[model samples]
Target: MPKTQCTDGVVGAILASWRYDISGISPEMRRDYEQHLAECARCSARQRFHRSLDGALAVLTSLSALFFLFALSVLKHIKPLEHMAFKILGLDIYDMYHMLISAGVAGLCFSLIALALVLMATPAPSYLSGIAVERARLIEARLPERIRSIRLR
Candidate 1:
């Protein structure tokens, strides 16, 4: 597609304010912006880039949640050295393990809430699903002819 600067600066600014997503707007109100996007390459490209960014943020937050959960699980399996702090080092930090456990649990909860917010506030799910569908089609195209035929039936 040929790159074209926005024809109307005011309309471009308005669309930018909405992040180029007019799905929540009334049909009548969205018509002009839709037309602009169809005619203006810059706004459409910006929309795609923003949606991809939202999808990437959602994915990152979900991965962060998983990592925190994994950290908590690993911490649960580790046994702290008992009595060694008091006898060998003469330090009475008996609550160290408990503190670490508390921190891990807190981090896990925070990450999960972040992930939930990302999923709720962004268009990431649909974007990610579209990506998955495209990937699946590409993989299917790479399959052998005989395997592909067996699946088609």
Candidate 2:
């Protein structure tokens, strides 16, 4: 019924409400939706769009996890520097250091959990892996002739 929806009638409305994703549904119950999706262009396109969105979310969460990990590593390396500076300034920096480390650790844990959830709740892992494979192929194609020939073996 919405202007953005290209599918006509009740099935379209249902699919739209579900964001065109029936991955959470049981196989038996999903058969109908699967059949409809196969027969319907608009719904199938919407399904692809939703899957891509899920994949992007997974990638973002994974990147966030990596960033948090990097922050923790940087903080670890700077701990001695911070201690020296604070000692010279005659300031109490232990509390601040502990707080920052705690925050970084918490952030890293939360992001990792989020990344895991995204990968588990959607088909993002497969989608992302497919993209990686394509990128690898592209890179390999650009390799020098000698290296390419050696790689083929």
Best by TM-score: 1
Name model 1 segments beyond 4 Å from true: 1-4, 25-35, 82-93
> Each model's TM-score?
0.79, 0.66
Candidate 1: tens digits of C-alpha lDDT, residues 1-153: 237678889999998887777777889988988999988888989988988988888888888878888888876775556545445766545577678778888887888898788777777787889899999999999999999999999
Query: In model 1, which residue pairs have backbone atoms overlapping below 3 Å?
Result: none
Please report, in order, the local distance difference test score of every candidate based on alpha carbons.
0.82, 0.82
C-alpha RMSD of each candidate structure in angstroms: 3.6, 4.4
Give the CA lDDT, 0 to 100, for residue 59 in model 1: 80
